[model samples]
Target: MLHDIGGQAPNPRQTKIAVVGGGSTYTPELIDGFARLRDTLPIGELVLVDPAAERLELVGGLARRIFAKQGHPATVTTTSDLDAGVAGADAVLLQLRVGGQAARQQDETWPLECGCIGQETTGAGGLAKALRTVPVVLDIAERVRRASPDAWIIDFTNPVGIVTRALLQAGHRAIGLCNVAIGFQRKFAALLGVAPGDVHLDHVGLNHLTWERGVRLGGPEGENVLPKLLAEHGDTIAGDLHLPRPLLDRLGTVPSYYLRYFYAHDAVVEEMWTKPSRAAEVAAMEKQLLEMYGDPALDEKPALLAKRGGAFYSEAAVDLAAALLGSGGSPYQVVNTYNNGTLPFLADDAVIEVQAAIGARGATPLPVPQLDPLCAGLVANVTAYEQLALEAALHGGRDRVFKALLAHPLIGQYAYAESLTDQLIAHNQEHLAWA
Candidate 1:
């Protein structure tokens, strides 16, 4: 946390933000947010940094055009150098994919061979991603820290908990970012017929493993409308969660979509085998998105970008950055920061995603209700797995990977961990340096 020389008032100074994975198809969405949110986070410059030269050119050019069309005054630049791109920037946003869609394809496939749920950021697959991603992210973070020591590192990477913990352990000023909580905020707001700003959610637990127990109106002290939401929208919400309405009604809480992988492990594994990997789908969409960006007249975010996923991501990033940089807006936003006793059961250093008051000093987790035994137990289980996953990610080995997988509730069986560990290393040999 940096010292606040000025009071809690919003800082009007212009800022420089560098997007580490600027070549991603998602960059335009972020650029669109910056254009619309100029009043919130005034940008002096926005740099796009990526190793892929071709994609960087397309994404950066379209980014400049989008800003120009929106009458935004910020400068947009493209670069392959992480150090130069981050040098003197106020903040850096990380949205990197190490093996591109190919690695993600492997991550989503191999675990299924051993009868485990195959997903990018959980189970055996997420472990593989953590192995491939953590070192790369750490290397890049070192450059960011050197280039701009005071810059805030906002990570939007997959397997966010493991990657973020790695960053924080290394003593970087980092806070993980995800769009899941914001998705719920937007949904509840739309249902309540109130502006999203008026809604505050009790988003507890870790990334991907979270629950919305209470949805309050106005501020944190406002009336909790969670019961009304469940009673009136149970069926719709159940459909979204893929859980039986009885289960949601029984627990009196709405779990995140990723919970489906756990709550219905065998069912999801059987279904995942038949469907193409999400990476394959996103790759196809990225092709079309790049084509659309090449259009000289195209400036606004294309409809196909929605198909690429990450709906309302730019808005969340804008709000979070504005809050973190002390630009303005409400005092609280849901973010991935250290627990610091937010969950009494979890370690103080454990990273949890919950409502946090953001400012120049950093985020402090807001007060949350006592966790139900069910949610607390699951949260504790996953947090242990994440810690082991980070260990395996940092110091690579087949045994370490196996231990991490065994720690996961979904792959607790010794047989599954052994076979999945072998398959993970085999599938991701290129991405895993030790392999």
Candidate 2:
């Protein structure tokens, strides 16, 4: 069904892909992937769509040069108009930040004042991002539907679980993606002395809240080398997560680094208060990246971009897009999609991140072994918060914001929820129309 676009199958070599936030410092990283993995996705045209004219031109120019340098024949173009850019495209990638890093700096800093972890995709800060992002993303999806009805929207936006749910609820064709799974897969492979493709993760839970229950070699049914990985590389893996080695040994599972927020809330809050907000560091990094993009001779992604994070982003994007468009990609990948009984405990419409078969019909989550009560309870708690968050994002009101914040496990107390609600409104009033 995914291949049947307007009753005609899409030509694999004529794929057109659009990056909504084309001007972002992250664009080059994505472009680098398109160039390096051209055989995987086979993009005929790449469009960079953004409202920021200056940054769009700079990123667009670098993108073309990168393709040229790689000897890939894809035509790279830039445009400020959204509809024009996505028209007839086979896939559209959403990476826009509604309020940019200045707003992200506010999202990361304000919540710490309430004794909660300040993060762009979790806690009160995440709620702020979801509220601003969901509406804009829905509007863009609507336009994409009108312009290219069969175009698949590959959302790499933060608060992915929430945004993808919004698109699906509105009846749009979409899939949510993140680099965390691929990043872990690569790290585990290196530790086991194997290829990244040879590694398969029994990765489950909501986006940003997943745990790797099993790390299989060769395929999903292949030997689960997770326990071996923990035994051999416990200290190294635990160090990366910033969690205690004993915790991993006891649980016998690998939690994503984001879990540190929930697993060690107060300690993380204390550390966040001491360090510069991640958003601030990224904003400074973006300034430098933009200046580097102005360089005409730089045809490849800079080593400095590695420090910008989103590790393995391009590979993940290309894989998801290729699979969804009926091109040859990995048979299985970790993606965010409808729960649809994947976790029977949650509503069928709830969006969840898990390992699934990726193909033209979109993601089909592999059967999960029974989840531990410890992780299941946390996943359920966050799912409830996400549902409330979506309600508030779709229909804004101060009360709705307060309800979502209060529902979050990190801010269950009414007093803290009230404070965060007021702070979030004050900081993001410009973007929230109801405010």
Candidate 3:
């Protein structure tokens, strides 16, 4: 049985929601959703929690203005106190970055030194992020558990699979969320010239590493039009993924762009060598965004925030929160939840991202057709790396870190793993208690 937090159901008209990293530039996007979709999840109170008091104040001010402009009745408040912010929240969203973009810059750059893709959420860099992030998230989750025992924890942190597994292993009432699925739903909907809600994706695999095997119209049982999408708009999709159209044609499924780091590792490494790390770009963007937020006249999410990434984040968060709170939302949405035999090859306790029926009880993955060996092989490999990553995150030791890095498909060479492990520890020593 799923663990029950045991409380009276939340009053839909008076729901209290807390965002742990609420001072984020991403908060405006989320606030935009709460204001626009108020009827779906009527929040009586919304709390923005962050240790950065200055950013909290700026973001909180904007949040209130946005809500007022939208004529939403919800009260918006800001706090640096985690416990106080989450005290009575019906749902708490996690989007904190443990070491900020500086650490991320390190995560991105150091892996490239060893000729590997240096992304914040994949390869050796991802293991580094997992190490820095998992412990912090678990600590925050524990605080929420104590302050709001019935509060549902929605994790949007990077390296989501590893962090989420740590949460479940510790018995926190948590579910992982990402924007990839919803992004696809919107993209495909536009291509099909239908309402976004009318499109349902047969999205399956682990977080970040997923593929859309089928695109159903009207509903899950609706006719699959994936082939139609490929035939007509294959070039657009391939260009977006930075991969060739023939590859998608050969696979007959749409792989997440993250796959490029794996499918074209050396190519991506070469590309990274020429471009600034994504962290640098985001850091610069954030500076500009915070300045924009301080403008009293700016009451909406900036167009620049769109380029800051996390596309469709607000909608996905609102939908997942509503469904988990027993409020109204789409019956089928994609989320990261316990495998529970969803994929036969993975451990039941493993976390996988797939289209699921989300309700107050939590996410139940829909039955997935057998995965083609091409995708399954990679998924299984990454799942193993994720398992090892969680173990290292939960405990702290150089050996564990090295093993996780070695297990990752993107950095399988023992020499690279060993070098990356040392660099990871050197860069993240302050965050890792045992480093």
Candidate 4:
């Protein structure tokens, strides 16, 4: 790793940003994104917090190099101590997990064997992960209050909505981050062969669990783009591409995985054991890409001012950051924010993802017009699950956990729900000792 001592003096009023999981494979891109903002904004210091010393050092070294190369050297510190890392920070970014990816794969596949949707994003997988995470996340939040009392938490963890809601319920300043909130519409625009700028969409519900109620072209035919997209690219968009395509096509519109559970229905799988073939195909493609690229960590270290390829580095994420920073004074698109009774279908205090006007203060959730029956039911189930999980966390009662599992759509029967709940709790013996 290299370091560059920049030629510029530090701005006294700059904000300090702390990325909690700096060792994560995804941090390079995010760090690169923040580095590019140096020219337009005054960021005083950058902190990378991770428990692994080697990984922590690598990221800190990268940040120093990036800053020096840009001729704007900001103080860079790496630490295993989260308290020291978050001290004086303006934002705490989280992307940690109790169980790694392999464990997550087990969480998904095992539930699949039980005839349930196997995804960390929603359903049983989400509920299980949420149960394990609530305590840890709350601990982190309490520290944030003590260290940086006014700091905002930018959560990038799985069970995004659930975890975000838990922190908010505890009265912390936090907002969950989900690419699905905006990535789905971008996918829709690509299928229609139009610039994403030319697409207009309305989305609502929870993270990885939402429905796109409207779609339109910004051009002459501003009518709903759903019927056309469904008629033209329906099969290829939903079928050939593995993702929300099938779910969206079934609803005759797009399904935002922002709240995926809402879109789970009888047609999502064949007899509930198999997902559409597109998911399999996409998985294969992703596997091939990983095999070709291997772990990004193995390559020669990224340059101090290096830029990664693809839209993630170049377009979408950059656009979102710029919009939030008020770069062009362009209106920020709506996104998931705390509902202040704006959405009638969900509880007033529920942290729901909706279209919002973003600014320096961050996202402001907008009111949704209405929710279809399926979407409404999904919001209800997931919201109820979160509430029950909170109750379980507060009281340390496994009964609350059992009730959450019982309320799941696929396991709503009293006997089946209780049996599955007992089995899961039994299996998670080590983690559930407190409850």
Best by lDDT: 2
Please report, as a residue range, the 10-residue window in candidate 2 with the lowest summed lDDT: 1-10
Residue-level lDDT of model 2, residues 8-60, one tens digit each, is: 23354589998999999999999999999988889877888999989988888
Q: How accurate is candidate 3 locally (lDDT)?
A: 0.89
Cα lDDT tens digits, model 1, 1-435, are 111111223232579898999999999999999999999989887888988888888887788788888888776777887888888888899999999998888888888888888888999889989999999999999999889999999999988888999999999999899999889999999988999999999889999999998999998899999999999989998998789999999889899999999899999999888888898998888999989888878878998898787888899998888888888756888889899998888899999999999998888999878998999999999999999999988989989999999999999999999899889888888887888
Query: In model 1, what is the error at residue 149, expressed in angstroms?
Result: 0.6
Q: Which residue pairs in model 2 clash with each other?
A: none
Error of 1 at 63 (Å): 0.8
RMSD of each: 4.8, 4.1, 4.4, 5.5
lDDT tens string, model 4, 162-248? 788888888887777666535556777888788877776676777666666777678223678778877787766565334566565
- Per-residue CA lDDT of candidate 3, range 360-414, in tens? 8888999998998988999999999999898898888999999998988888999
Distance from true location, Cα of 77 in model 1, Å? 0.4
Which should have the higher lDDT, number 2 or number 3? 2
What C-alpha lDDT do the candidate models reach, one value each?
0.88, 0.92, 0.89, 0.63
